[model samples]
Target: MIESILPSYVVSEDLFEDPPDTMLFPEEEKAVEVAVDKRRREFTTARLCARRAMARLGLPPVPVVPGPRGEPGWPSGIVGSMTHCTGYRAAVLGRSARVATIGIDAEPNEVLTQGVLEVISLPAERERLRELARRSEGVCWERLLFSAKESVYKAWFPLTGLWLDFEEADLSIGPDDGTFSARLLVPGPVVDGSEVTAFSGRWLVRDGLILTAIVLPAPATTAGSPPGASPGSELIGS
Candidate 1:
């Protein structure tokens, strides 16, 4: 499902499993020893998926530890993201030379928990979701919106190293096109030496899963050059 939106050079991998108790690297194994069995499985599986993606890029399959904020600590020169929900796990990766940073998320197609929507959405976002739900009968617009926000934050945090409030991004979702645009409500973060005020991403609802992805390109070597002229790549799903 994710292969369509990503650029050809990016790698997107997925697994649905009760992951085995694979021995993790020292740091990662120690960190997860305290987690419940289920949490441990999810975390281990996500890391395994990440390692495989990186290995495909001709990089070593090293241990992916957690950063200070619990984001995956990828190998040097790799920019990537990971996400997992019940029965679903995925990881996306691109060489830092091809993509500056990337974020991907997957969620079961379902409604947000009661009152959760009210907390995460802006007034305008809620209104937009209603219009979208009216137009697209099958999608859970609330959940799609939430997933988009999660993708946005995933892409945002690596660059900013700061928290983005749920209401901080104003999203305009086009259900018909499976695309979305998020305009930063706060001063946007500086990425690769440029201030990014907005982000464009793609989303799809398929086989009971809602997936979304966002990629930030490395700044162009020259102002007018094309995306791939820089050192990085972006992800898209089929």
Candidate 2:
């Protein structure tokens, strides 16, 4: 059975338990493939875990179909996203009536190299990470930033149906009520003309696994839009 870790998020590790039998595909298989074994495995595992979690939530499982520009499309009535890395797999689900966007990500705690961090982080965000590192020694600030960026992508794409670059959104992380809170510095017409929104949320590490969830307010409704066409989108950035 799938397990619910938060009100709108759930997790499963079945993918880590049993890797997919890629050998089943013929050697001459012409399907597109990624050479990174670890990433392929993680993606496979994450999808399996998400399917099981959806079942536990009493929601019909939705096949994650990639839309134009690589965004995932969910079955009707639910807004959600998934992420998996190394040994972790997770999923987030939101009811259409309650939330317009939901994003979740899981990653292992490890030191991220300075070079890698620089590539993914904005200057202001790097400064905040420096402060956070000074206060909390050994925290994986770079990884968290990377994951948060990924989550933002997952959450944003479906709403705008547009691709966002890693530098488009800025993120800040700090201690809050015994957990970490992330605030997003998002700009442009995509955010409904708002310059920034505090996408507040929390994270926890349990048994060597780190899980984070961020829920944004449902976007304002338009005069003549489809029932599920809100301005908000959900994502997983790990």
Candidate 3:
């Protein structure tokens, strides 16, 4: 489901069930050493998926340890993101030379947990959600909004190495297009010499899951010109 929404240059792996054979790297195991069984299972499985993605990129399996903010640390020259929720776990990777950053998230297709929408959403976003809900009762737009912001932060953190609060991004979701765009309310990151003022991503609701993804291509280069002369490639699934 995730691959359908990403570009060919990206490698994506998602697991519906924690593979019984999933094992963590020695270094990775220490991150969750004292966690409950559930935490260990998801942490281990997400890394397992990440390693599988690395192998697809023609790289060897390595420990996918978390950074200070819990962002998965990727191998040099690789940019990626991972997410796990309920029965879903996923990892997406791209070469740093071809892709600037990637962010993804998965959530059960249901209403937001009580009080979550208020904390994460801007007032404008909440009004839009109501309109979307009225238009299509099938999708949990509130939950989708939360997932989109999570993707925004996942992508934002890697570039800026700073925190992006939930209320920092104002989202505009398309009720029919399976897409959304995030307008960064604060100063955006500068990627490959260009300032990223906003982000556009794709979303999907299928079976019992809602998935969202954002991929920013690395800037194109030329012999005489500086980077960011043109986007490395068109944004995926735009």
Compared with the true structure, what per-residue lDDT tens digits does model 3 show for residues 37-88?
A: 8888889888888999999999999998888989898899999999999998
**How far is 227's C-alpha from truth in model 1 (Å)?**
10
Q: Estimate, for each residue in 1-238, the C-alpha lDDT of model 2 and write its tens digit.
A: 1133344233333344545553322321222274366655655556666666678668665566555565446678777777666666666665665555666677777766658887887898889888877888555777777766666666666656667777777676644432333344454324455532434445655555556665554555323333322234321122
lDDT of 2: 0.56
Give the winner by lDDT: 3
Compute the lDDT of residue 87 as modeled in candidate 3.
Answer: 93
Candidate 1 lDDT, 194-224, residue by residue in tens: 6778777888888898988887666652243
In order, candidate lDDTs are: 0.78, 0.56, 0.84
- Name the lDDT value of residue 80 in candidate 1: 91
Number of the top-ranking candidate, with TM-score as the measure:
3
Backbone clashes (count) for model 2: 10
Q: Which ten residues in a row have the lowest lDDT in candidate 3?
A: 221-230
Q: How do the candidates rank by TM-score, highest first? A: 3, 1, 2
True lDDT of residue 73, candidate 2: 60
2 versus 3: better lDDT goes to? 3
lDDT order of candidates, best first?
3, 1, 2
Alpha carbon lDDT of residue 78, candidate 2?
A: 72
Report the Cα lDDT for candidate 3: 0.84
